[model samples]
Target: MSLEIKEQSEVSPFLSDAARSAAIDNKEKEIKDAQHENDDIMCGFWIFKGPLLQRFATETMYVTIYGVSGCFMAMCFAYFSGTITTLEKRYKIPTKTLGIISVGNDMTTMFGSALIGYYLRKVHRPRWMGIGLFTIVIFCLLNCSLHFIYGAGEDALKLTREFGDLQNITGNLTGSHKDQKLCMSEESTCMQENSIWGPQLILFGAQFILGIGQALFIVIGLAYMDDNTTKSKTPAMLSFSTFLRMLGPAVGYSLASVCLRWYIDPTTEPLIKPEDPRWLGAYWIGWLILAAITFLIACLMTLFPKELPSTRARRLKCEKDDIQNPMDQQMDLSLSGMWCSLKHLATNKVYVYNTFASILYFFGYMVYWIFTPKYIETQYQQSASMATMATGTVALGFSAGGVLLSGYIVSKYQPSARSMAAWNAIVDFLTVAGILCYVVIGCEGSDKLSSMAVTSADSCSASCHCEYVHYAPICSPNNDTYISACHAGCTDNTKDQLGRTLYTGCQCIAPSNSTSVPELQYAVDGPCHVDCFNQFLIFLAVMCFLKLVGASSKSTNLLIALRCIPPEEKSFALGVGSMVASLLGFIPSPIFYGWLIDKYCLVWGKTCSNKGNCWLYDTQALR
Candidate 1:
């Protein structure tokens, strides 16, 4: 019995050592397996599936690509805004028609956002975004193709007569001007040669396609960012992206200013100066640049994996922790499941309130965004290029700064959702008050063209056929502006020392009691001086302030919407919110503002007897 016990004790030690070795081996295998899983992802066997590729699969990399693409997208829109006036002139589109074209994007969003938001939740997000961007590339090319299709209509002053020829001077100015000859002639009606429908349909179609491409940016992009980041870090990341996005407009408007300085058709030299109201800018050049950048962005977006590396790790951990918890289960894809998910959101009061607030805000905000450049041009008599540059540099720059500062504060303090809401409320009230100031701001418009009120038979130059002239104005030294040199009764035109056209022998400059001025009278080219520089400066200051305060709420509002929804419904909520906002806000805002603008038109450029673009606006009524 003693010998058997001694043998068993020695064997027991060997068995125990073997067991410990096996356990250690198993643990080491698990560690290696986990490391392997994290180091590599199953995106594909192509370039997307490499250890080297994994190095770039980070939040920082994602944010960078997203920001640059966002900049390009924003640049396209800003360029459109900057060049809208020139487009109006080039196409002979009235403000009301222009407004209809502007709303085409929102119309698609109003219908498609809900579907995109809900169905795109589990798909490869970056690849889908890439598809959307590709569509945008198409939109850019298509929209700009209009200029190539229809040439920038002939310059208004392109005369067939030789220099010093006075015959047929009282003819239709190229699109926007009229001149009167010393020799009186019978009036003739101009024939309608251009079709407005062609240009209008093309623009609307382009914006509609653009709307489809923009969905990914509005819905998926936000959710992707929030998913990859911690709750506390999300605001900072969003602010960074938005700040970069805002820079796009600044650069875009600056580019517009540069492009507009050149004639509409770069191949041809313009006879009329850019200072003349008839100038058409080179608006198509920027679209080609935007298309090339978007193609590169598309390639980058496709290379990213379905889920980011960090997000994948967290998701795996979460699945393990909540393996038995039904409430933590992933969303269901069945029809009934979707209905239930939607119902859950429908009942969510916080989401409902936040969405309504967004709708109201966007409704009021889009008008200013779409028309500010045109407003600046008409109200202050600033050039289109100057107005666009100012809107982008001063207004959009201050907005970007405000968003960045707000994000920094939120990130540093990690404020609660309620606190964010309270801050937004204060900002909202301040915004309303600031916008009201624009109503009180004022500037005098062009001297009412007295020629329009009188018949040529009763006028000082009774023989002049002024009825057939266009709406181009000529400024007299008396600070009065006539509809045209013909209306001013100028018998001859000559060049000045500075090379500007000078009209001489003007009968219209005589005092009210005198039949005509006996002395030689003269006037210069272009409109009379508008003393609104001081008022414009004040308007700019107010605009800067309003943009600053209004933009501060962007991050806060987004954070509030995110926090109020269930984790799985983040994308769906954003999509639905955007859909509602489009239906109630963006879809109608531009049209309403456009109609209001058309109502104040004092002089419309006539295109074959149909009312065309407004040459002059009632500045007071506009305010």
Candidate 2:
């Protein structure tokens, strides 16, 4: 020690103190930069490289374009859900058939994700996105073709001819026509039964295409975004992208609400007004518009590089073969590693158990979200548009808020796996409590309301001999709901100054006094009683709280699932977990619930031979 000190003392006079201090500061800064660069940032199931230190000029554009792409990915779901009832009504599809369509999506999502995830390591990302998006547009066009073909062309002729036998018939709702049959001839019914396969294929094929497209766009787009950005910015990019995606439901439902009021075939005149039960909307036009927007974005994104300038450092860390397209290179496609990971995941008690829990969570979620619009419309006697708008408001607003709030909590506390699980457990428990409110808080079914109940043929519409075809609602003097002006025995139909369709001289109105005729009665559209609005409000409030409690589960589930598994198995775990949830939850929940709903059909509308679709629900019978 003394010899080293003596040597340093002799050399000290040659060096300036200021120079020494500057050298020490430079060494310290280098150490700090090295430490920052070496840190790994955990985001969902992926870990990203950190702190590039230098800023790139093109990050803003990258973030904006990716976020919008995410928005496009989300558009289909929101629009489909908002307009499901409209599709059923227009195409004469039943709830069970619609559930079948949903199953197509769930089934493909699992398979598509598995395929896309494995091959994504070897494919050019933007190229895949473009191809996927184009397929989406094509299938969407095919799906839209239903409107032009089914109800307005040769297909319509078949339905018209099938129903032609019923044209001469009257008052089939009751056995008042007991002397004669009210349905079609046996020959017509037999042929009509086989014809439904075409429409079914069209619906299922379009859904299947959409499901594949969704899987490609979502999984590949996210992976591409992560690969091309610095860790410091990647989290923000993904979060904002997700946030924008949620906005799609709001926009979709709002747009669909307005468009649904228009005739499905723009060039043809609608047989009934928007408020009538028989009205069909322009559901296909929106897809064309979405396709156009997606095309523009997809083309623009093709110009984006595989990796950004900041990502070059990380790219160079891994060895690679020289190729014209980096993404086209071969990857580790062997099944052994994946199988080993799967086995490891299956044995990890927490991961397996939590995955099971997620199934129940998703099942409950699907039952509520997919059917809430129908529920609101049925319970409140609101129009389809109004119900969609109402549910969208709750879904878009409360769910987004819940996600942001949960993210904030995670950022602030940096909760460990155990802590996060505890929080989710508490939240889910409360969610169940909130879910119970639906049974207790709902408005009485339309059948229970004096003014809205379906009346028997003997009491009210027996003399009218109504065919039950026209659905222009009218209220009787007894404050009871009748199917239409025809059902009320109204001989005259006229429009008032405010453009309200009025039915007068309704014979179904019983006399209040001992007089032969009742004072001239008028029945307009919609519910006559305004008091039912309160029930809808109460229902919305309960739903709002339920949303607040459980919305974060979606993002949190991925977090816990990833945390519970080995680092190497995270991607596989997520893919497997998603598949399990879909199989147990998304694929079956709708169908199961649909079966239950079918049992409560008060009136089934005819569509050729087989049971067509439910026109009126027996709300009192619904569980």
User: In every candidate, how many clashes are there?
Assistant: 1, 0
Q: In model 2, which runs have C-alpha deviations exceeding 4 angstroms? A: 1-64, 151-195, 224-237, 267-273, 315-332, 449-454, 457-473, 484-509, 514-531, 563-568
lDDT of 1 by residue, 121-223 (tens): 8777888888888988988898789987987664332421231133235443322333333313456355374677888899999999888888877788888
> How high is the CA lDDT of each candidate model?
0.76, 0.62
TM-score for candidate 1, residues paired by index = 0.85
Error of 1 at 543 (Å): 0.8
Which sections of candidate 1 miss by over 4 Å? Answer: 1-49, 156-185, 323-336, 445-468, 489-500, 504-507, 511-515, 518-522
How much is the lDDT of residue 2 in candidate 1? 71
Model 1 superposed RMSD (Cα): 7.9
